[model samples]
Target: MKVTKDIGVWTGTWLLLWSTLAYIDFFGIGGISLDTYFFILSFIVVFITCYLIAKAFYRTPLQKTNIVNYKFIKILFVIVTCIYIPILYKSLVLMTNGNIWEYRAKAFGSNDEASILFGNQNLRILYTIFIEGGVYFIQFAFLSLYLLTGKKSYLFKGFVLIFVMSIVMLGRSPIYYYALLVIFTIIYRSNGKLSLKVPILASILACVLFFLSAYRAGGEITLSYFIDKYIVGYHLYGFSLFEKSGGANSFFATSSWFGQATLGSFSYLLLYPFSKILSINFLYFNSQEYLLKNSFIVLNNGDEANAFYTIFYDMYQDFSWGAPLIYGSIFGIVYGIVYKKAMLRKDLNSFMLMLFFLNVTFGMIFRNPLATNGFVGFFFYFLLYILFNKIMKKRLHV
Candidate 1:
């Protein structure tokens, strides 16, 4: 049986992922560009090299599941979903003012929620667990339960949770996750086999939810905002600025990126949502600061730069010309290890971790996502999965 996660990993890595660099940086303005060539060539080279290397390390992915524990996951995800629904409602209805997007733009974007967010340490932790913590895991959990257990209630509740969560939070990133969910749900329905109507209906419903989310965010929806803010918002225009303003060349002089790897530039940013809870000091490392300073997009438009600390940017900051190859090979080896392990265990939890890894890798193209609360939340859940597996093996002796 196919792992189902392969879809996200492949597309997230090679197919539709890294083109944003070229799309915004050079091609946005005019003629054939050298930077465009570099970005594309690097992407192709890295993708092929990584895939081939990972292929070498692959030892038959997880084929079929023998153990049955759908009941456990069903209760787990459903409980979390139920807990989250009310918190989400309270956060929206009582916490935020005015429209959803406006409140988000003010709280997260402007960072004005610090007082409310950081008022009490215990509440902060509780809020984190309630909001970004369990909620993130439940997204995957709901789908897994639905697919594995054949429960339409789980499916309906999962989709509704996703839709309402995105609407109340005013976030658009969940669109990708929903698409991935549809793919996985279809694939797993037949126990990793594919059919037409299941996937198709899943996709149609996802789109419906997406549009409903957009509508709920504000009564306004425009192609330009969607394309520009979400799509173009992730462009690599900062590279052009780096090229135009004479190469900084300072990266080669130091091993700063090594430090960044251990604690990424935005790792603190990842913990920001939990700052009130954890009492960790986090500095603002806005991606736009570099964009407005260098890239023509910000230079001309003068809009707040929503820069994507693009993969190349982080790699370049760490290793100038060798960024792609270095990072590419590293991720290839890591991906290979996970693929091999998932193949060996053939468990749903391990498979979900693989999916999470793929999502992080793909998002790395646009932002340093590995260090975010989203990724951190997944890490803890993966740990819990490992512990749960141990407990089950020890007690149930299955």
Candidate 2:
């Protein structure tokens, strides 16, 4: 069942999914207006065009190594769980005794609010690194093991950890992330083969998300409610950003747009985990001011909140007209190169690294995954894998 290593199809499909969803405006939150349609269509064309061009230059990786050692991975998993279990217990206690919903609200409310949720900044930092970051790395590794060995246990173990972490955090994004990773791993395992089961699995995950959202709200939520609030609301919020900012004209005319378009966003994307302590002023951009002013989530209860502007929302804010042509093309080229090494050459490390890029790709409907701390986790784990390979190779003289 070997298949073509064509990531363009995968990337294009996700783009179409979100764009089509935006077009449908299913619950009539806000249909894609003419300007939004033009922007969406243009971005898709540029992204796919650049992806195809880079894909044309594909070459097989020169060095493929057998990095998935069962014994080593088993030991690593045991060690990570041991380190995490105590922290997990503490988080569970906090969720039960504390105003967990308020905590969740704070986590999403603002950076200042989120920074102090765990009683002190240090504990919050530890919680983010070991729990939020750790779960992703562990699940990614376990899923990789599952693909290599065809053992369902590894997949189950990863899901359990992610599930617990999601509950403790009182959020649904982790579940979405794990589900996306599962889809990616399965596709890679099947040599790019796809089946009807993919959509079925996605539907099942959507159901799970619906339930999780209801649980978080402490009430029964309807399908239409979930669709309008959770699903359609984010895209609508994104559209509002485009409209409020005056679309592409904001790039040249707006001073605030300069902050979003600068290298500051990339610095935040890659080094967010360290930026708090480092205090590098030049690398930081206060796009938060623009987001707060432009993107506000209208709650069902008539309250307003923020966050979850669509993937291109930030890019559009940053580069406007150049978002698709420049940022889109850059992403397409990089992704095309990685897909070749990971899928075609069967390079384990590259395959794992590709998962992070895949996260960014799939997250086009949501926000940029690279802008989250999970990218730090993925990069950290990728390095760990490389280090382990070197140590193992030295020991085995491979």
Candidate 3:
């Protein structure tokens, strides 16, 4: 409706940025030796897919008023706070053979790689349920509700909630989510005319935070070190570094569990929230295929690491070598439709959906698609939205 950018536009742009980095990293970037034809080809496919999505669907955010029941938001906030505050307190109070920081570092840190795999699975699972589980629930819901309410008090409370969640898992994702929400909200308040400087600065700060978190366990902290480690998020060197490891071509040349990865993950979303509530593992939606591949990725690298691959790698797990091109185009079509429908309707639900998609997109290919992980979060918000909408007696002013 206006001459400006929107969420989908920004998301598609992110795709382009990551893909470009992939190309530079895969090829000889400033005399680096990580060049590979397959890597470049993978990035090409992703860039083109992003182009298609942008061309076909990106639009300015619809300028409209959205009304929600203040009562509903308050109740939602109270419920979220009651659940998480206690967990945060427990994480601070209890100890699993040591403090919270040591627990996290050993369980998942590079310093003690096998900590999670070896530590008391029962205690670890409990820690995950209480502390980490609340990240998505309270953070997004509280912040989104605050954005809807536009109250300074609500905003401050939302920040506190995020702080509590970060105490447990202050990894890249919680930080990224917080930054994106703040930036997106700021851009929204600016009527879609936000200067590029704000986001650019925010990005630098986020990266610094990411690097600082990684180095908090006592290691080198420098610009060059950050660039060498976390800033280079993807495994661009890939399995090709190992002699017997299968390269990208070898991956596609062989068969894989296509549906079990793609549709199976989609199916797994249905039960994930329940399993979390029941204190049971979600089994990554029962797709052991990723686990098997993760082992290979570790072997190929000769390290003790989880097989958290890039988006292309996840798609490969689903559809083999064709993952980068055809599957990416498919995502373009799917997300394009979501973008079109949501923008036309001024639907916050749709906006949240795309935000989660971008979350995983920029998040790299370490976990299940956002459609599953983020969808579960969105599904809860959707229920809340419906309840609020039905209870409202009259339309409220923004």
Candidate 4:
């Protein structure tokens, strides 16, 4: 793939954006009080290693797959839409009348408790489909098809789904993720040709994000306040935590009693699904305790210092001083190989998988996406793709 389309470049770009802001401490609250020379060195080592490995694998031959049937996709879209509409309707009816942000807050128990989406046990079975499955992936599939087939209907469906989901979910991150996927799809479709619209869309996305955040904060917070508390707060808090603990002070290291009985924070991403499947809470670990305990901040009415602790903090908490080397190297290898297959070979299935993996990569500036129920969502995405591919192959053979 072209350097511009590389996943490592994409990850590095986002990491730098937030990290730079944190380092500058633009609000001058001493965001990062400790020296980060070694931390930064660790990141640099990972970045270079990952990029080189990805480039080296560019020569790998592309894998072949049967073309997906648009007819089947249209039927599948109808089915998924049917499955989700009632859920959205019930959620809207249950939520407060005026506030939009309350939807996400309620669903995930971020700031509030009356979650109409996730709180109900009967309705929780479809959480995976609601989160990263049918809703968002359908939009991605239609958008990709629109680009390839020049089908306006596909484009229209994509936008309609995006609009409804954004309004219903009221999540700024999902919107940003969709925007990133759009940009990536365009770049891949155009064979690495950089479009002028990319910058334009980014500017628009930035504005939308700011306004949404301000609205969520009750419209009393200013842009500077939002950026400082959120955009910059993640790394600032992360670095500060590292400094205070003297390295490796996460619950994993400290909570031996809990760790002996249950999995640690690092295992949360990997073991979450089985926990959900078997109804075994012990198999899964929740990072909310860690995030709340570690990332407290008082700014503009005070909160849990922004939910984004940055991947570095999570790594350091788990691996202490070795976080940089371990996480950086692992991420590098995974991203490098995935970029080689998805972006370079232009495999749509691989691209879809790449997009799913992006929940971790793009979210590195924030907390691990897998910290919550994201691992189950990723599993569903992969499972659905495999099943759909089989159906497509069978149809082609018939």
Candidate 5:
């Protein structure tokens, strides 16, 4: 079904509001304090850009389709397998570098490690890219094709394989798995509409489970914590007083809290550049010095390591206002294009596009948008899709 004018308006307005809030929360009103106003303007620019792009692509003529063939699929599979070998080998080699893992671990804990790792003038940024990038693009390729082709069995098998691999390689982050399931469910639901009753029940269950998990995790609770920490606490809440809270009260109180908030924030930020523009400086860059110093004190005071927050804090200190908006916008545009293109394919559905969008969004939020690993993965995936279609057409004599 074609996207209606109402849907377009709704999407644009939602994106604009969310983006503005997030950008403000992240970057704060710093020196010169143009952030808030700049963010508003940026939101308008982004919305118009995206709307125009969508309209153009949707209205453009679609390329003729080619018939599929087993031989073509096999050839494409072989090519993909070959390309993966080197990527896999390089990733493994980098994994052996203890410093990378140690820094990654430290970065996870709320330290300056992530900033140090990325900030080191001599550090090979490509290595960082290779280590964290490829998984999502791989996911996009498999899912997009399955959606386009309407091959449930193939999609199911691919999901299982990718899911298992992610768990094995990335460690235990339920958010990643849960995200995949959410996207798949959304996509599978006919016409992207979940029954209101089912969604309401699911939302209730999710809230209950979240509280149960938090309670089990154990922490002091307050009104600010509930609003800032729990309410807008997800990644999208942007920079607020809750983020200003220091010590154990900071949002990154624990790994689980950090994971949940980060995922939520990342999802919205990457999808909406205006949000990133507003929040990036304050949340990720400018706040680093404080985060590192505070986290260091907390460490001395018997707090568990908050290395990841520290790394984020350090990033703010290093890059200031420039890093978040510039990087975030570029990444958002790229991913938006991918999502738009994926949607154009007859085989894919909104569900698959949502999944791909989420993965891309997360990467852009936490890591540099231009990280090598993500770039290579995305490039290969898109290239493979184009090649696969070409080979299928040639074989079928279309």
Candidate 6:
């Protein structure tokens, strides 16, 4: 496949647009704060690393025989899905029994728990590990299968696995499924462009179906949530603009803008170690009091903080200046390897690249790795690689 100059331009443009959006989302529009600087620097590092990987894809020659077989990928996916079933079942049990949120709070060392009810230390630890580990492995299997098998059936199966795991572990959030749908459509589309009529009609159908699903799920599907929570709360107040009190909205509060700004910039470097240490200290030593007392801003809903600002702030609280450099370097190296390998194959496709991009955006940049299900990240990348090889072979006429 010949590398088009347009592809390069599109890649560069996407990076620029998303990075800017991310920066604004993280730091607001107050120019370069400590967080902003760290974020930009880390992003640049990751961007360069990914760019090299994409370049390698453009340069590498195609292969004749399959690198891996579809049967193997399918078996792997099945094994992973089976492994997740128990964990999912356990989470369902906990959620249904009304201990899900309580368990999360206690696991995180929240001082709100007056007494320890579940004294099965081993079981508790196992459950924690299972939930975390299961999600990561499930993601890996799903992504790997998608990459290895170009079959849309496998891709849909991957999405279903991810969706089930996410719902079980994280509760019902439509975002994951929506993201999967968008990615799948992008991957399956013959080209990026859609005829005006086709795209519009498809989009309308998607919206209608989304609402129908939500309605069937017993939740009132209102446009207000998207407008308020995701759009204004997340996109507007959460990024680029400040609230009247220089705080985040109810659904998305952060520490001081300065604190968040300082921490967010270097978050790529700070997030991992911070998560590791906090997880240990909170889980083992019962250190919730310190965090709560020292918190710059206490959110009414801590789960929101988990997805929004907790990771960045926690890192800053833990490792100050050293966080960004160490974390950024490690993340950059891993991303570099993935990108390099992908580029070398010359099989990188939009779907594969988009998955990588979203993983970095949602997992690495916006949320804490520890707080998230690592399997989702692993699954997305692996699936992309598998799908890239499968789909590119057909699309590129290799």
User: Can you write out model 4's per-residue Cα lDDT over 1-398, one digit (the tens) per residue?
Assistant: 34366667777776665556555656454445334535745675786586677668656676654446455456657876776687678666755565655555566553334346667543453464444456656765676575555565765576566655555566566666666777776675666887786787777877877776765665567877777665665445554443344433332444332221122333654566777899876541344336453455554224344445555655554555555666677667776777677654555566665666665666655555655343454456546667877887886789
Candidate 1 vs 6: which has more lDDT: 1
lDDT of 2 by residue, 1-398 (tens): 44443566777777777677666666454445566657777777887887777767887658754755545556656776786677567666765676657656654334554432355666665556545666677776777667667687877898887787777667787778778777767776776787665677788888888998987886698998888677766545555444444554443434335333333334555455565568654233454534454456554334354555555666666666666677767877887777767656665566665766666676666555555654565556556766877788798875
Q: Rank the candidates by lDDT, best first.
A: 2, 4, 1, 3, 6, 5
RMSD of each: 5.8, 4.0, 6.8, 5.0, 11.7, 9.4
Candidate 5 lDDT by residue in tens digits, 1-398: 32221223433454455445654544232111234335334534554566456545543234433335334444545554464566455444544554444534433233334433234422333333333333444445455555555565554444443443332233322234334344444344344544463456456535543553343234345545554433343333222212332312232233222221233333333444654767644333223333442342222112232222311222233333332344334434544554455455443333344555554434322222222234554544445556776776686786
Which candidate number has the best lDDT? 2
Q: Per-residue CA lDDT of candidate 1, range 259-300, in tens?
A: 244235345545557866877643334443233333333433
305-374: candidate 3 lDDT, tens digit per residue: 3444444444555566666666656666666666565456545555555455555554443444443333
Deviating ranges (above 4 Å) for candidate 5:
1-41, 53-59, 64-135, 149-155, 169-189, 196-358, 362-372, 388-392, 395-398
Please identify which of the two predictions, 1 or 5, would achieve the higher TM-score against the true structure.
1
User: Number of clashing residue pairs in every model?
Assistant: 1, 0, 0, 0, 31, 24
What's the residue-level lDDT of 245 in candidate 2?
Answer: 44
Assess candidate 4 and give its lDDT: 0.58
Task: Note the Cα lDDT for every prediction shown.
Answer: 0.53, 0.64, 0.51, 0.58, 0.40, 0.42
- Better candidate number, 2 or 6, judged by lDDT: 2
Please report the candidate that would top TM-score against the real structure: 2
> Candidate 2, TM-score vs. the true structure?
0.82
- For candidate 1, the per-residue lDDT at 74 reads 54
Residue 33 miss distance in model 3 (angstroms): 12
Off by over 4 Å in 1: 1-40, 58-75, 94-102, 109-130, 144-155, 184-217, 223-255, 259-304, 340-345
lDDT of 2: 0.64
Residue lDDT tens for model 6, 102-199: 64444333244432333455544343444434444444344534544544565456556656654553533333433533443433342344446345
- lDDT for 318 in candidate 6 is 43
Weakest lDDT window of 10 consecutive positions for candidate 2: 256-265
Candidates 1 and 3 compared: the better one by TM-score is 1
**Lowest lDDT block of 10, candidate 3:** 27-36
